[model samples]
Target: MACLIKGVYIAEIDRQENRREDKQIAPTWWEAFHFKCIKVLEDDVDSSIFGAVFEYMGHQIESPKYVIAIRGTMIKSRTAIRDVYMDAKIALNELSHSSRCELALEAVEGIIGSTHHTNVWLAGHSLGASIALQTGRDMAKRGYYLETYLFNPPFLRLPLEKIKCRKIKDGIRFMQSFVKAGVSLVRKKTEEYDPFILLNSWIP
Candidate 1:
């Protein structure tokens, strides 16, 4: 599945470089698995292909009917700044407010509406993973659980796992839990948006 997602990245790079024939990644590589590119979602900021939708034409029982793969941050590229901006948004817990996230959710909803939710899968990496995670949560809230794979999703907190002392790590964990509980309580009482509560029914 990761290979198929990587094909999307390669296809975008080839598209940018004008590579074709045997060098093309979309039809050339995906055809091996009987998947065809159905749609290419572009970044509105730089017009770069950020997501690709692939439809499975094979009769294999394990194959997903459709797969939406989202590319992660491309370092040193034109979309890098926008990607980093989204990364910051994740850290700020504002990813749901991103236009790109909205686009991804809309795409997934369109597919699920046209076909069936059980036949679709979502996969993403890094910043794209954040988008995918948020989109999955949104779909789950709507009572549609789509299989999702997220690679290297960002964790918006200090790396407590790096701390050598167990006591300090436990202390930090306790404080973090306490703060989170307090925030959840406040949000619930105020009827504010609480994704954790909304995501209670989603496991993946």
Candidate 2:
């Protein structure tokens, strides 16, 4: 799998295929020992070849045991502030948008649910961070001990407002650090796809 965003992926292999890959076809216990060290969450599975310029924004490697939902482009959502981006408002509108969070929550409940979790971490990069923040808020309302990591969420609003949202900021820096290291190693080992060149800026 090749991902533009480092640890995240587009999910190429179906569940059945993944199972097959995990357990190789072997004769019997007498057969030669063979093992496959496979990492399903490699960068090769990411969405953009032009992923984060700041690889330090998102998650590192998520475990199957944990229900992790990552929102990609929340900027596309039709929020009340959609027109704020018009003309010179492109930057401001992006900051005020909340509709993307709605989509992210729906996706999380729809895809990552079914199995319950006491601790669920929702994360996103760039504009998606805002969505993650919103999702975390909703998850909290549902009584889930949700932790959200927003990677360089573009805060085009008043500095005070963005600062106010910092509680949800939670593991922003930590998440970026964790993911950046993973992306670097993956890129170095030829294990997965490359990350966005801008990742370094956010990591620091």
Best-fitting candidate, scored by TM-score: 1
Candidate 2 local lDDT, residue 125: 60
- Candidate 1 residue-wise lDDT at 179: 98
Candidate 1, residues 1-204, lDDT tens digits: the string is: 676678767777877777765767566667788998888888788777888889999999988999988888876566678878878898899989988888888899889888989999999887878888888988988888888999888886688778999999999999999998998788878653566666776775
**Residue by residue across 1-204, what tens digits does model 2's lDDT show?**
012222332222222134353353311211222211122221222222111111112244442233343324422223213322221233544432333344456555653465554334455665445555556655654555455566665554334446555655655657767988997787777633333332222221
- 167 Cα displacement, candidate 2 (Å): 30
User: How accurate locally is residue 107 in candidate 1, as Cα lDDT from 0 to 100?
Assistant: 91
Model 2 off-target regions past 4 Å?
Answer: 1-99, 111-113, 156-204
Question: TM-score for all predictions?
Answer: 0.83, 0.36
Task: Assess each prediction's global lDDT (C-alpha) against the native.
Answer: 0.82, 0.39
Q: After superposition, how far is residue 147 of candidate 2 from its true place, in Å?
A: 2.6
- Model 1 segments more than 4 A misplaced: 20-23, 159-174, 180-194
| lDDT of the structure predicted as candidate 1 | 0.82
